[model samples]
Target: MDRLSNLPNHILSDILSFVPFKEAAKTSTLSKHWHHQWQSTRNLDFNHLYFANRDSNGDVQLQPQIFIDFVQQFIANNNSPIMDKLSLTFSQPGDFQETVEKCITFSVDRKVKHLKLDFSDPTWDENDLDGLAHPMFDLPQSFYNHQVLESVTLFSCKFDVFGFKNFGLLKSISLGWIELKVSTVKALLANCACLESLSVKSCWDMDSLSVCGKDLKLSSLVVEKCHFLDPSFEIEAPNLNYMKYCGTVVLFTVNGTSLEEADLDFGPEFECDESLGDSLYQSLNGICPTRALTVCTYMLQVIPMGEEPTGMEPRLNVTHLTLRTAMHNYEQGGIRFFLNSCPRLETLTIDIDRSRRICNEYRPPFEDKFEDLWRSSAIIFRCITQTLRKVEIKGFKGTPNEVYVMLYLVNHARVMEKLTVITSSEESNNRGPETFRSIAEQVYGFRKGSENLAIEIV
Candidate 1:
């Protein structure tokens, strides 16, 4: 007779979807009408950590046997044959291998479309200097051959790739901290003909990385921080529109097909190679005719070595370029080189936000040499006089150098309409509201090339 229980099946299922399965199953005790409603739910999500109640001392206290029994019983009682999504996360899998396998089988049998499995160890330090290791759970071979599967994600697990079969609708795949063979990676990628995006990060146990999607719809690729893999890495996606790489300094061959945007982050620890300049130039050439580019400060070191301005073929046709910098004086030379090479550039953004990037990548505390103007581009380039319209400087802290750049653009950019030097939430608090007024007065007081130019400081 409860008003909540009187709701219709569609409405009840919608409400229950927000809650865990254990809580949803409790509705059966409320009324006869709600008894079997939980059995027909389509989205199945289970987490061992949730059921494994903690003790007074903050340790994981739930019994493994109890979790296994509950999971096995829950799947057996559910009647839905077509699951839209299934996600399972287990804190520890050594003692519960059968439990993990059974849950996967249950979802696979019901034609699950989207699947995600994570086996992060509960006891391990989340931020341990060393990263995650392989988990004990073994995914069933049937998971790879499922015709109805569309997207798959696996984390911190080991699997044999030799059994992978064709997936008709698989469009997206994301793997991290996993172990597999080089041949297996190639075969799996080749099999997913309809795949549109693939991401692999922090994984190990491979000699060479070769991804071939010649006759497929693969368009976006991102691979990052796979330290153990061999130096040799290759990709054959002609239609790739976006790429982001953060690791070693190997030359990536793109088969002459350009990207709309490329974000390259050779990690902070990357040591400069003898061919650093050549590798950097080749990558830009491969993704030439690009509209946008975001490069880390470390990778920009070789730009001033004469590998640019002429070595670049077709030159970069970038309209929007984002340069992540350490705000170091040395990196400014490289930034100037890029501006000269990309003649079509219309908008330039300089970001000094190092909190989100790797450690040691960005030099701390704004430098004091800004009062001297260092060696900035004083010659208002042709792009600034003709095409440059907007300029944004993120993480603005009223540093003298940052203010100088703002004033430079305001005075030189003939066609620039608006210039923004915005501060993040944390930065805004650190720099009180008075800082904005000072910044605005400093730039707006100058006689700009364009009368319509507007300057913003926040």
Candidate 2:
């Protein structure tokens, strides 16, 4: 008995929607009733790389024409009147420009709510010199006239902001590897009246950016690795709740009172300067109201230099704090600064970022010993004694610094409830079971402040 085949057509179509279109198409062979169900799927995701055949050397042999033909056939056969999402990822648009235009037109005509087009060449390294020379696909004029688009993601595509129209319904947009002028970005934001989220990464031809609008509904913004972007970044979105920035230290004037979370990674220590320290201070002060904060090793190194000579009082309202570092001795001052500042912090997370170990060589030599740094500190953080409940150490290797810090937290956080140590994949592979058992025994032997504290090693 084929009970699944006996199900209602709409139910079968809904079920098929959960499977990839390629796999869903295979269900046609199951029964005559299932033959047309796939055609009614609301979401269409086609990746040309997935269709490409591999050669003897395992190199991808792109079949652009074959992929084009398959997509054309699918669109022709599909009977769905409306689409929830349409994602097309392919390269070499010069080989089939018309087909690509037609696909965009089809999605717009079907009133797709979500559209993602990634034209990044899979064979090229985007960071390489030659890769920067790769041409970008120009979006068709029809792409600008959509009235139902709610979300859009574009990668390695070139298009003018002047072509934009009727984006009243658009809510989210993500752009990567695109050359956009600051004015062009401003114009795009002006057009997206209802936009709630925007992400820009690796964009070029922009030295400065300002995201300011009184009625702007944007709630989240992400900017990363725009090498040309200078230090003058200004944001004034009162509705913004989340922001993630990764790049060189920037002079930021963030005025979002609603900001709740921020992840800041100011790249290598080589980029840091005394003036940049003030900029970092200003940036951190602007987002002081953030309830949850995440910062990298670069920020840790710069914070001490940025602090006032008289020393500012604990001002951050952060309840949850995450530090990404190499746990080097130079970072001790920064770590202490954060512990003192985040008075209300309830959850603490330390992520060992191995890539930041290179920063040690560039940083000025510190006379403080790693083991003695914490043990010598007499300052009592209010969070450790009263508020902190959980602590997590990721990329743990059971090193002396890690063990000392773990013991310090275990012995100090009187109200703490749990401590979790997640061993790094590299450490787990290199160390034997006996080594782990020894580490566990050491953790268990620590004199905990809270008798009910639960400890876990994974």
Candidate 3:
């Protein structure tokens, strides 16, 4: 008389997909029919969070060995010949690394398509004084030889991938907070001919890294927060569609046939070789046909000042352009040339500094009370903003300089349909309602080209 005993096995398996592996196995207590049904489940999703809250006294360590044993025994008794995915994230120093190696071997034996291993402790921050714990598990050589692995993600592990011979179907790979030799990364990428997405974040200890192959089919690449000793790279991805680099710019060469979006962040006191900007400008030359572009204020500062973009043409087809500036520097105003470069931009967004940037609080603020605020050389060609239909200003404080910026956009963007003004919580708390009223008065009286233009402030 079980409520779900009559459901077909396919329907039960579909329902089990919504629950974690351990929870799904609990159905065995419902009736004798379910005793062996969970064994045939195709996914081995063992997450520590599923059983983590039951910990005694909220200890940072994993909840208990019962949950661990349940998952291990379940996988040990698995009968499925082919698993769709095998994701295990038990980020504590519980089992030996050999146990994880066996689990991966088990997945490979069953022809698992997607595999994820997150052994890194979630609470272990590298910046903490005594943060080292749960040593990075070393991946077995056989883990890299599995041709059925279409996607693989490894966290907090050291991979000696230099010996890998084949990554036949691997389309995506993400490694975070891991350690690896420079030669190992090079060999791994050289073997992954079909790699489409690559993400490497917060990894350390490298002098130089190079990834280059004429037949490489990478489409999306992200390199974030990897503070290397001598950060350098040489990447040639001819088919990359999306790329985001959020760290110190390395000396690298990345070229692609076509790119749809590119986000570059060089804030947070990150820097690169003097030649980085120049080389990046050349790499961008390959993807000048990009539709969406985002750059932080630090990179914007560097490109205008140092990078020799003398002969480079502007990316006119960019439909969306986002600029990240420091909260305080939003008023000092130096991004006019960057805007003009994107001629066909349909949306213009101004964001606060990407990460926690050390703001210079000692300098006195500047106030400019001008009717015609924008005086940059780029403003002479106000006709370039014909396609700019929407404008959003985030972290807007009612500083006099910010008022000037608002006035410029209100004056220039003749056909703009909507303009949104969003203030940071701190600004809303500190500044009274009069500050907003003052800015609203100017916008109310500003002569907009479209009579239907709507300006909303928050």
Candidate 4:
């Protein structure tokens, strides 16, 4: 029956390309026809964990020598002239560092386009206050000057930024769990002329970051959890369309008017003070041109505390907005502030934070009625009557406050076409079918502003 093995060589090579390198190598044991087929694969991914041996008691025993021998054997057998990608992930190279350097040289000589090298130690405690030293893996100089590389990802590695050569064709770069200086980062960015995406996460030793280039083609940027980074951050790329930042509050000076989406999260541990609120307000104002936006609970609580700029309306151009909150009483003011600022908002989504729901015992509940709090003034928001079309409420628990807010939106949003209520898993598990049926009936009986309104509950 082995009819699949009878296919032409090119067809077999194409099929093997879709399989992982380890699994593809297993095909060689199936039949003689497949012995040489896997050698033609254009992509190679070697991970130390994949080749780990287990003891009789089922404890993992890392065999660096075995992994090294297997890779060397593959390189000896592989005859491919060009490689699309080469990835190597290992935790402890120990005395085999020279072999790791040789592997990088081999991939570079073959003109691999995408490269990923991860040497992170999985057992290292990321949250340890004492800060244990990270495993060090230095990249060879051969990887710096490659003209054919289009994307590169490095984790827990060190390399001389001054040794960087012309990376004219590079389009993406990601660096995580590493130590980098401001000058090194700037030098790297200056050399990669064609880069479109850049991600830097969990890095340290930099006090400030400033990415400013007029002719740069970068369209996406992400910076997260760089603990040593100072409060000052800056960006001026004109073509940037997407950005994501997660950390403590910082002074942001963004100048990208082409931004289409942005996600900002001040970590859950953030506490708002007047100065921090002002800094957050400045950051938000700078990114107001974004079309779609996502914000966290801490941001909602702090935004209302910051003062608006002089002579500025404090309006945002966002059409779609997503809020991540614990549904605490403090977040109500922030929600109202966003509703008033986004005049043309079309879609609204509220995702309740489940992890913080039970732990928010210190925060007090809303003493005023939900309807009265939301509709205290006669000034009607423009989006409620003319712009908003769809609303989604996730993690619905059928609490009194939740019900009041739902009814208020049903009565106010005239142009709304659809309302979706997604109940939490806990609510469904604790309630019976009769309770759900009663809820559905109550929702159906509510007065809707739009005659064509459609409701869904799940």
Top-scoring candidate (TM-score): 2
lDDT of each: 0.69, 0.79, 0.67, 0.77
Q: lDDT (0-100) at residue 21 of candidate 1?
A: 68
RMSD of 1: 5.1
Winner by lDDT between candidate 2 and candidate 1: 2
C-alpha-based local distance difference test score of model 3 = 0.67
Report the lDDT tens digits of candidate 3 across residue range 1-458: 56677889888877786777787878889778888777667778877777765357766555747657766787677766788889988776345555667788888888988899888777766443134544777778768768688888888876766444466888988987766557767777787767888888767675565666667788888877775677666666677778887766555555544678888776544443335456556544544677888877655544533345322365456788887876344323235545656667788888853343532422212242232336342443342357778988886666655666677777677678999987655546467556755665567887676655799877
Ranked by TM-score from best down, the candidates are: 2, 4, 1, 3
Q: How well is each residue in 138-207 modelled by candidate 2, as lDDT tens digits?
A: 9998998788899999988988765555777889999887776788779988888898999987776676
Q: Estimate the TM-score of every prediction.
A: 0.78, 0.89, 0.74, 0.83
Query: Per-candidate RMSD vs. true structure?
Result: 5.1, 3.1, 5.6, 4.1
**Top candidate when judged by lDDT against the true structure:** 2
Tell me how candidate 1 scores on lDDT.
Answer: 0.69
How do the residues 1-458 of candidate 4 rate in per-residue lDDT, one tens digit apiece? 87887789878887888889888878888777777788888889989988898899998888888999988888877777788889998888757888888889888888999999988876665444128687678787877867799999898988876655566688998987787677877887787888899998877776787888888888999988776547777888899899998876777788854889999988533465656667777788877688999988887766666664111266788899998877766677677778888888999998875455322322322345445764444645788889999999887766555666677778788999999987766544578545644564477888887887899987
Once fitted onto the true fold, the runs of candidate 3 whose alpha carbons sit more than 4 angstroms away are 1-7, 15-43, 53-59, 126-134, 141-145, 160-164, 270-289, 300-317, 330-332, 352-358, 361-384, 392-407, 417-446, 451-458
